[model samples]
Target: MTPRTGGRKLCGADELVFYDITASFEERTIFTDILKKTAERVFIPLTVGGGINTLDDFARVLACGADITEDSADKRSLAGIFLSYQAPVEVPGVPLYSYLRTITQKRPELKMTARKFRARVGEIAEQLDMDSSFITRELNVGFSGGEKKKIEMLQLLLLQPKLAILDETDSGLDVDALSVVSRGIEAYRASCDGALLIITHNTRILERLSVDHTHVMVRGRLVAEGPGSLIDDIDAHGFEQFEVAAQAAGA
Candidate 1:
């Protein structure tokens, strides 16, 4: 029932009409034509883009209209849905790596040029500093958190997915190990025209990364977002401001 600009009339609609508006009074009223037009509309909840690359950009977009965002607990509903191939969701209750032995058997395409395939996988594995011997072993078998993450990156290199959503990829890694993980990630970024989404609270791994945007989600809602600089700021100041913003938005 919300119509923004260029509407001649409003037909008699349903009951309980109300909308949320997220904007400063100045921006809402400064533009004479837009303000007049808004006064004529039925929406109050401004859809301000909670994701931003800079504070000025945030202000700019808010001036326009935006108010929505996302992240985890989202693992199942969000990540699970987007991931259709070779994900843990494919075989419930089975360790992801356990399927590796039989996976190639399931798909003939993976078996073609098997020798080249193993070598290719070895190169990527070494990029992660993962031992070549571990290839035949089960996944996540006595692997450290960082090791597991690296293996995940190995899968990414092998599959070359068009889009990858890595939740908490840097959860457990020391400074040195993180560099290996980052390198693997960078390699995958370089090898394909795919998109990568790395979700984590840590900032060290991002130091040498070329991040397009970083979004901060508080209580499952995105409160702020910006460029790579945002990561450093968050590492230093944390998400206090974003938490407050999310709360205010909900209220």
Candidate 2:
């Protein structure tokens, strides 16, 4: 999750940037439609990308109510959106401390009472058996992949959105880290009134996080949706079976 401008502000008010570098055109269209609907209801800015290449594509996206920013060489002009950013996650000489300060302030809601923040941070650090200072610093920078995921889960705990989306957030965690991450996710579910959409290929992480729904994607389409048990089946048999099933249906 990208850190918000301040700790207290809720998400969705600012432009939401999606890095969909490998999504298909149809998938992009569907995503744009979703963004449009979401923006209409929520009244927030939406920015989308990944595999975009034509002026008409930009026009279509903008017509749907998005502010476009394109990093690709393809030049396009759309009324609702403006395109920029040539590379993903590029910070050109942006001061890390300044950036962190901005995020901390912009999402002020995320900043709990200093006592609460410190207590929760301490508890999480203790649970992970790390130093409190280490956790604080890690939350800002120099975090490993697992640590970043854990911090992100912590952020979710703090923010408690109506819906949370985890896009392959478990890809590189070790067993212990995965365990910690799962516990944080579970804690969020137990404490918050929110639903989670976790996009992960690994089933082990699901052991702790009770998934209300599971979805399988193939060729940028939702090929299957089922209970958490689907994760078990996928773990045992792998997605090859699902791919075959999808192919058979297409045939």
Candidate 3:
């Protein structure tokens, strides 16, 4: 499990580091001790994969101080979201339409312009049953928790990251609000071929999602993985079984 550090001397005291697991499963142990030592020293950006079949493997990887979490969603705004949908490869200091025209010559499938971008975002807002004006509001000012989540969904629709990691987006919503959020999520799913990683403690949101896989995390590690039906099972049986399984896995 020799780390391909890309020539970055990890032994040096640095505030940040990125570690990706690339080898087969049996070699994971070679990394555990190094990560534990490094974690005691600095923050590590980690990705663990390869031959990790069970949730227990996820738990062990994270347990080796590879766990990481983030909350950058609050800093992103609705206007910013819309702006991200604009063509990024466009020529600098040129009108969006001009850059769009240039892009169209190569990829004729794209029809982009500043006007159409706004129209599309507005159309999405309307589909989510939201006021178009709110997209330009001062972020989440004067909005309820549910509204904030709705705006996040709008961002998800427009920005469309390669992997959408929604961390408890359904936390404080009422039934109606939950339905709206669910609809927005379904819309986003339909709009792209991207991946979604929904992190949550409640199963209410699962009612509308076409979940491919479900994983339960204990502490900061995944402890179970199953089909969408696992959501119903968890709802009925709770995390007692998962908690025990996690303990056993760690032991």
Candidate 4:
């Protein structure tokens, strides 16, 4: 197979680099090697897509140093799990309400029309103390930190996923917004009997919910484990002891 040609006389580095593949199944492995080399050289936001079929494909491409993995929607969407990101990306052209509708529609089990779904979203937005006009705005485009987190909470509540993974939802949020986000989380738990896996350093959000387990991780290693009280201890004393233990173990 012949490799495609492209060129740019770069004085320094480009702001962003995109690598897209249209290789046949037979040529997938070849592009994987190419991607590895490109990742090694490119120091910008590199988004790679095409011919990725499974989770393993994503893992492989990411391991190759691709910054973002672009795969099919269904492949990335784990059926009963909802993940609220710490930093939500903005999609300028997509309306918040439409995006939510499309995602919910992907789950055949979720039976609701676009109109009804819009109303449902508005109700959740109100609960988050967000304006109804936000639904008409572009997804995360110019929203404040609190608004973005609230939008995530809105999605979590609307989806009613069996498991919600919240990644630092409290980060950058003020006290009121934190309370609103926490309430949305609790509503999901109460209504769906859903489980939560909250990843955060702030105990403020946890103070509102009933935490069953706590694990202190340092340098990607779990150094301590305890009940919910561990949160209070960490809040009062800080992670100094845990960090010291992790360092000792590594040494």
TM-scores of the models, in the given order?
Answer: 0.58, 0.56, 0.57, 0.69
TM-score, ranked from best to worst: 4, 1, 3, 2
Please identify which of the two predictions, 1 or 3, would achieve the higher TM-score against the true structure: 1
Top model by TM-score, which number? 4
For residues 1-251, what per-residue lDDT tens digits would candidate 4 score against the true structure? 12223422344554434445646787554267876877666555456645555555655665566644244445445335578989899999999977988888866667688788877888888887899899899999999888899899888888787567899989999888898989988888778866789999878898888888998999888799989889989999999989998888889
**What tens-digit string does per-residue lDDT give for candidate 2 at 152-233?**
6655554455456677777777888778777877876788765677777778878876667788999998898888888888
lDDT of each: 0.58, 0.59, 0.61, 0.76
How should the candidates be ordered by lDDT, best one leading? 4, 3, 2, 1
lDDT of 2: 0.59
Cα-based lDDT at residue 172, candidate 3 = 72
Question: Which pairs of residues collide in model 4?
Answer: none
Question: lDDT at 167 for candidate 3?
Answer: 74
lDDT of residue 224 for candidate 4: 90
C-alpha RMSD of each candidate structure in angstroms: 13.5, 13.8, 13.2, 11.5
Better of 2 and 4 by TM-score: 4
Name the candidate that leads on lDDT: 4
